[model samples]
Target: MISKRHADILKILDSSGTVTVAELANLLGVSTETVRRDLRPLVEDGAVHRMHGAVSLTGPTAEAPFRRRMRENAPAKQAIAARVAATILDGQTVMLDTGTTTSFIARALTGHRRLRVVTNSMDVARTLAVTGGNRVFLTAGEVRPDSGAALGPAAVAHVLQFRADVAVISAGGVDALAVTDYDPDEAEFARALLTCAPRRVVATDATKFGRRGLVAVVGFDGMDELVTDAAPPAVIASAMAAGGARLVLAG
Candidate 1:
């Protein structure tokens, strides 16, 4: 029941996480007004969400499903997680948000002992809870089936109650300007987690470079470290320098 234009729009959004009205029009070879018209029914059908001036598969389908996302860039994510895990000391309280990369990070923490792991991700909670020496806390909130993440006001409030030594997060995009997310509520939830933690780390792969999202979780300055499989583009280097963020490239 989807039109060709709608199908193409969804395809682009799936690959890049977000696309603006003007950008879509140019890519589709249609007028801006025409592209807007095409987006109306798609948005109504719960196929996508419109935010600010762009459209993305947000809300329930913020990125991709858990199992599918776990396979996407699996190797890169594991490397990033391993590098992130290496920086953590035993007995440290670490916080993480819901995302496949963070799930990998949780798996990487299994070897550490007596650590407290707090997360809004059901998968992350389950992964670490069964580990022999780690204590896991799953926050109270509405769990979105699509992402298996606890988000919204209640989750943010719950995160405020716990202060962490480090917070590991993932993003739809790590733009030259800021770290962004396609879901607004998730972005706010991440912002709350960042504020509650003394050190904040962002885990993402190289594909996120130059991508766009509906909302920015934080500016570059808010990130204490960025762990990825490859080095960032030259454009981000200036921002990292100005923000005092250390870039850690994993193997």
Candidate 2:
């Protein structure tokens, strides 16, 4: 038998499809930490899916729903974003990939003095577009409504025009062999960015470790840097050593 709190959580997730940790905490008259603890079992039981700071009834799939992903592990993502933003030089061109972590990076880049950003994420483009001293370019392609990302042959072509100083992308997983993505089109776009930039940087949280997606975007051997909230597993560490990729831990 489940606890009343667990039952309530399931009820909420079922009705709304998704809810944030803070929202659940508030509604349940508990602390955020408590809500997190409450969610672990449900997640293990496959009764709930935990995104950054949010929860949903659906289990982990090829792609997490966008809103839930944005709220999932938000603080860790922010930390990773700030680290990614700090390394970018002023007035340099950057290729931004589509993902919640990259969206946070876009927000972090708002204070940068000058930059040229080419991206397929509508969320990323919108976040930095209005910021002063920044030039934002949005790719043309079919937009995934939930993710707000443009991905297709047209988008890949648009991204290929710029030879960026850095390519900051997000990954569904960073395992021993490759960096992967849930969507094939998104993976293709990411690979295009990787080829166009000398510095290939992947920004993702620790939760992404060991999780593989439907397609591989780039192999571990091709990565230049990885920014994350925790130290990678031994397999990843070994791969990084063999590939000469630098790992940046945000915390």
C-alpha lDDT of all candidate models, in order: 0.86, 0.85
* Per-model TM-score versus the true fold: 0.82, 0.76
Worst 10 residues of 1 by lDDT: 58-67
The Cα error of candidate 1 at residue 164, in Å, is 1.6
Positional deviation of residue 181's Cα in model 1 after best superposition, in angstroms:
0.7
Q: Model 2 over residues 1-251: C-alpha lDDT tens digits?
A: 23989999988876555566767888899998888888899889887867555567765542456776787789999999999999987899989989989999999999886789999999999998888688989999999877899999999999898888999899877778889876789899999989888899999999778766668888867889999999989988898889888889996
Q: What is the per-residue lDDT of model 1 for residues 9-97, given as tens digits with 9 covering 90 to 100? A: 98887875656786788889999899999999989988987766677775565655456567778899999999999999999999999
What's the CA RMSD for each of the models?
3.8, 8.3
The candidate scoring highest on TM-score is: 1
Q: What is the lDDT of residue 173 in candidate 2?
A: 75
Residue 18, model 2: lDDT of 54
Candidate 1: residue 114 lDDT (0-100) = 88
Model 2: how far residue 82 lies from native, Å? 0.7
